[model samples]
Target: MAKFQSLKEAVAENLRDGDTVAFEGFTHLIPHAAAHEAIRQGIKDLTLIRMTPDIIYDQMIGMGLAKKVVFSYAGNPGVGLLRRMRDAIENGWPRAIETEEHSHAAMANAYEAGAAGLPCAIFRGYRGAGLREVNPNIRSVTCPFTGEELAAVPAHRPDVAFIHAQKANRRGDVLIEGIVGVQKEAVLASKRSVVTVEEIVDDFDDLHPNLCILPHWTVTSIVEVPGGAHPSYTHGYYDRDNAAYLEWDRVSADRDLFTAWMKENVLDAGPEIFAARVKEL
Candidate 1:
């Protein structure tokens, strides 16, 4: 069951060095605060997983926290390249990080397969793609019935999954509104899950039955963190911080600037600052 805890406590208990963790949210509700907390705690050698790895992964990778990154797309979102990630791959700055790339379809299916307790996810992808040449995980399986070859990738069963949501009730059921991604499957597929929410309400009254709600049984811990997804918008809570995304392109470009930025903004700051940032938005 989900126990209410601070972001610091949740990260300390559920995440650790050399663990495979998925911090998922898609375009919105990205768990920036939780990732920041992990950075502040100086967790290292993490195998980070995400469908779309943006600035947060860039920060983690830049800080030499990630030993490997498993993902579909890697970038700064609306901005240009993830300079830090590129630097790590190209120059081995901070550290050399291994990368496993996949397509959007493959990643989504892999997460789903993991949630279903499957060993691998088979989908019709990478037909003419170059990922198969480099990624050993990309292989083909012949269908037993039809003899059709399908792409197969190992399921993403992470040590823990982290996500940000709009709200959670007293029961600890998390509500994720707007642009849902593989967060649900990521949570269900993980050994443990941490959720940060904008607020904790008594109940979700008149909510649609089909809405995305991770039952308390599926969640291990919940942190009440308003603006936990800052820089990434939370539905009905705040807008995406476009300026931050723009500024990251500058901060992450130079090694000295990146280190200084992390020292001042992340190393020196705490999770409490995120709530204050949301007030300004």
Candidate 2:
């Protein structure tokens, strides 16, 4: 059921204004190219979802594309704070954005619950945490079997989920090799999914059957985008561009600099630039 399409075509066809989208990737295999394409296409007012919102989210937020962000932790990974996100929240440079914070465990459970088609994720968390006092979604449910109380959060059923995988076979089955994270559950939980991969192989013949493989039926689009996860490494394909991440902390610290960087690197550039970026790496 997955159609092979270009990144531009996939983004345009699948993503739209005011959609609740999740670009789910951990420290690795982040879908930077797809996010850039969405930015170039001028997608706006998204309710973004992720476990750890990193630089990719920062770019989208800085560009005034996000109306709200649902996440557990947000930062620049090893570098520092997400300046753009902070700016949007504090100064409202582009526009004001709302935030829903949660624990990492709750987010994982929420994604799993969504994948299981559950209404909410029930887990033992938020104990002594102030998040319960602030977030209305963080509610308590009494155990049916026991008299104990538990925490519950709404499941993340996004309109569309985006991820970068290592490879996809001709049948559109995607192979996600390293640090799978919640990419699988995110895709399964979403109404639609767009996957960008390093390459398209004839088939995943030699790979183990137990590997993290999303069947063609689960994905809406499979796009061959070499070096698509630049700045975030694709296992076995390229190394993480740490220098770029560091530079982003500087570039994003200033509104003018952030806009200029985005215009030059993302707006003026295309997916082809990603391939060139990793050629020397």
Candidate 3:
């Protein structure tokens, strides 16, 4: 099979309307920038799955790109301002599915099960919690082996998984530091995976073997974009634009203003435009 030549192309090729996509990143690290690019390119009706929804998710939701969202929390890049999400819920615009905060771990477990080709996985944590009441997707069932109550998280086979990495090869080998957690599971469970990297190294052996999170074999496309994770740092490469995040929080209270800002900064422009805009901030 021909490998993807660019991150933008990879996202455009893999993502479709109404497809379930798992975005990897937390707060402002290793975000799905390329996925947002794809959305700007006119992909719509996306069902975004993530542990937390930030500015990117909010932008997409506000632009009417997202049809559904499964996440623990939805807010500004960092602070709490879910203007678009609140609008959708209050007006009943789209299908808004709210999951428990633990739903992040549950979805991760489900992705692991899907990657392992198992029907489901049973784990014990936060039983009868407030999250359970909000997230109807999760089910409590009797453990087949132990006859004890357990949370049987179903497999989460997403249509695509989009993540950003510190480094990668042309073949799509990704290198990231610290705990991967749900990101690894998302890559495993998704049928197609696309990643944006700060730089494409010549060889995977250039870094410590253990630092390699997603191997080339699992990735379908590798796009090399310097400073791809702008605003959202890439650990060791740059620090997050905390001031920018703060501004996002301040302006996100107004959906119109937030949408206009996003269109001017993220949607109407590409990485180059965003880079310049960020520098001005």
TM-score of 2: 0.99
TM-score per candidate? 0.98, 0.99, 0.88
Q: List the residue pairs that clash in candidate 1.
A: none
What's the residue-level lDDT of 278 in candidate 2?
97
Could you tell which candidate, 2 or 3, scores higher by lDDT? 2
In candidate 3, stretches whose alpha carbon ends up further than 4 angstroms from where it belongs are 1-4, 93-102, 274-281
**lDDT agreement of model 1 with the native:** 0.94
Candidate 1 lowest-lDDT run of ten: 272-281
Q: Candidate 2: worst 10 consecutive residues by lDDT?
A: 84-93
Which has the better lDDT: candidate 1, or candidate 2?
A: 2
lDDT of each: 0.94, 0.95, 0.70
Compared to the true structure, candidate 1 yields what TM-score?
0.98
Clash totals for all candidate models: 0, 0, 0
Query: RMSD in angstroms, candidate 1?
Result: 0.8
For each candidate, C-alpha RMSD in Å? 0.8, 0.7, 2.7
> Which residue pairs show backbone clashes in model 3?
none
Which lDDT tens digits does candidate 3 get at residues 56-77? 7766776777777777666665
Ranking by TM-score: 2, 1, 3
